[model samples]
Target: MDLLKKKILAEGSVEEGNILKVDSFLNHQLDVAFLNEVGKEFKRLFEDREITKILTLETSGIAIASIAAQYFNVPVVFAKKIATKNLDKATYESDVYSYTKGRTYKIKVSKKYITSDDRILIIDDFLANAQAALGLMDIINKAGATLEGIGIVIEKGFQDGGELLRKQGINLKSLVIVDSLEVGNIKFR
Candidate 1:
């Protein structure tokens, strides 16, 4: 993941409130080639798992999850953050508090997309407070789908997200972790 660490140092910026903004390639504007590499890395990390589908939250997690799904050869299922007219009535849902938005969101995924027999891998652009991941995990549990692992592009190691997941026995892999976000300096773990 040296390449990912390099990309972050070169293109990432530290915003107010400990936010490591990697919008250039990882979030807002995408770099597909780089994402393909990320996908491959995730597959390599979770290669031994029996993954039947990839699950992610909407918005930022969509692109990353979609690319990773290519490597896993599974369909991507995203929880809808905003209510959509086409969403199915029968759904698995959970509430997630957004650190950036400063509010809670009810994310939902159609019941048809997840089931007891499915082995799921969760993917996302970042993991800070683990709120989104927790919500997705709730949905996975509701469907009785087994969560094989979680692949994170960037993790704020200064936060408790990764630690919490690992403590819960989650196989969490983060491409790059920002261990420190001091005013003019940045550190990685």
Candidate 2:
């Protein structure tokens, strides 16, 4: 986690709209070796929990979830933001509002991929408003799956996402938390 904090301080930038741009290594571009370490950390964090599968949202979360799944030796299931013909008609769906996109999207996952017997671990690149994480949790609930935990690469501590999850008794782990993104300064907690 310290390595992640260092990475954020070294390569992460504060963009407009309080966005912490970590695309250099965490997202956009792929860093397999570093992500492998991240995966190992997730494994270490959740080793006490039972995890049957890894679930995540589309796009940004896919890479992080996939890499982490290697450590769990589990398959990754991502909710599709956009509908596709290949996706099953029978799916668990949830609506999520994207602060960046300024709209809501219906994320879906095939019911076949998840079941009542599954113990799911949710992984993502960032956590801000908790909309996406809630949406993924909705899908897990619909499938009657047990949510083992959530692993986040970076969490904006200024936001309420972490608190909300903790209040709900969700097992959440964030490698790095940015308490503030003041211009020319980045505060971590």
Candidate 3:
């Protein structure tokens, strides 16, 4: 994950309110090569797990999960933040409060996409407040699906998200953990 760390240092910007904007390569502008490396790392990390499907939130998590799904040979299911006509009425739902957006929103997934017998691996771009992760976990639990593990590209270690998930006995792997973002200085753990 050294390449990812280096890329973060080179292109990531610490914005106001401690938000680390990685739009240059991660969420906004796509970095296929770097993302391929990310996929490889995630596959290596969760290779031993019985992962039947990859779960993620919509928008930012879509690309990472899609690329990683290739390595796992599983379908990627993303929770939709916006309700659509195509989405089934019978869905697993959860509420997530976005610290960055400063509001709570409901995320939903069709029941047909997930089942009780499947083992799910959650993937996302970042882990900060754990709200999104917890929300996704709730959906997985509602479906009676087993959560095999969580793969995060970058974790804000200064926050309690990673610690809380770990305390809950989740097998969480973060490629690069930022211990501090004080005064716009990025400190990694």
Candidate 4:
């Protein structure tokens, strides 16, 4: 976690609205070594959980979750943000509001990927409003799957997302927690 915190200080940028732009290493421009470290840490955090699958959103969450899945020995199932012609019609759906994009989207996952017997671990690059996390939880609930835990790369602790999930009794873990991101300064907790 110290390594991740250092990476944030070294490369992360503070954007307006409490956003920490970690595009250089996290959300974009891929960092294989750092991702491996993230995977190992996630494995360590959820070592005792019965993780059968790793669930994430498409695009940004895919690479992170896929890399981490190597440690969990679980299949990665990413919910698609965009609907494609080839996508299965039978799916678990949820609506998500993207504060970054300033729009709402319907995320979907094929019903075949998750089942009642599986324990799912949700992973993502960031957690701010918890909309995406909530959306994923909806899908998992629809499938009757037990949520093992949530593993976040960078969490804006100033936001209510993490606390809200914890209050709901779902196991949530974030690697790097940002306490504040204002006026080009990144503060971590």
TM-score-superior candidate, 3 or 4: 3
lDDT winner: 3
Alpha carbon lDDT of each predicted model: 0.93, 0.93, 0.95, 0.92
Stronger candidate by lDDT (1 vs 4): 1
| lDDT by residue for model 4 (1-48), tens | 999999988888887766678899888799999899999999999999
Q: Which candidate order results from sorting by lDDT in descending order?
A: 3, 1, 2, 4
For candidate 2, the clash count comes to 0
lDDT of 3 by residue, 1-189 (tens): 899989988998898888999998999999999899999999999999999999999899999999999999999999999999999999999999998899998999999999999899999999998999999999999999999999999999999999999999999999999998855578999
**Each prediction's TM-score against the native?**
0.98, 0.98, 0.98, 0.98
Question: Candidate 1 lDDT, tens digit per residue, 8-125?
Answer: 8889888899988889998899999999999999999999999999999889999999999988899999999998899999999899999999999999999999999999999999
RMSD of 1: 0.8
**lDDT of residue 146 for candidate 3:** 99
Backbone collision count in every prediction? 0, 0, 0, 0
- Stretches off by above 4 angstroms in model 1 are none
List the pairs of residues colliding in candidate 4: none
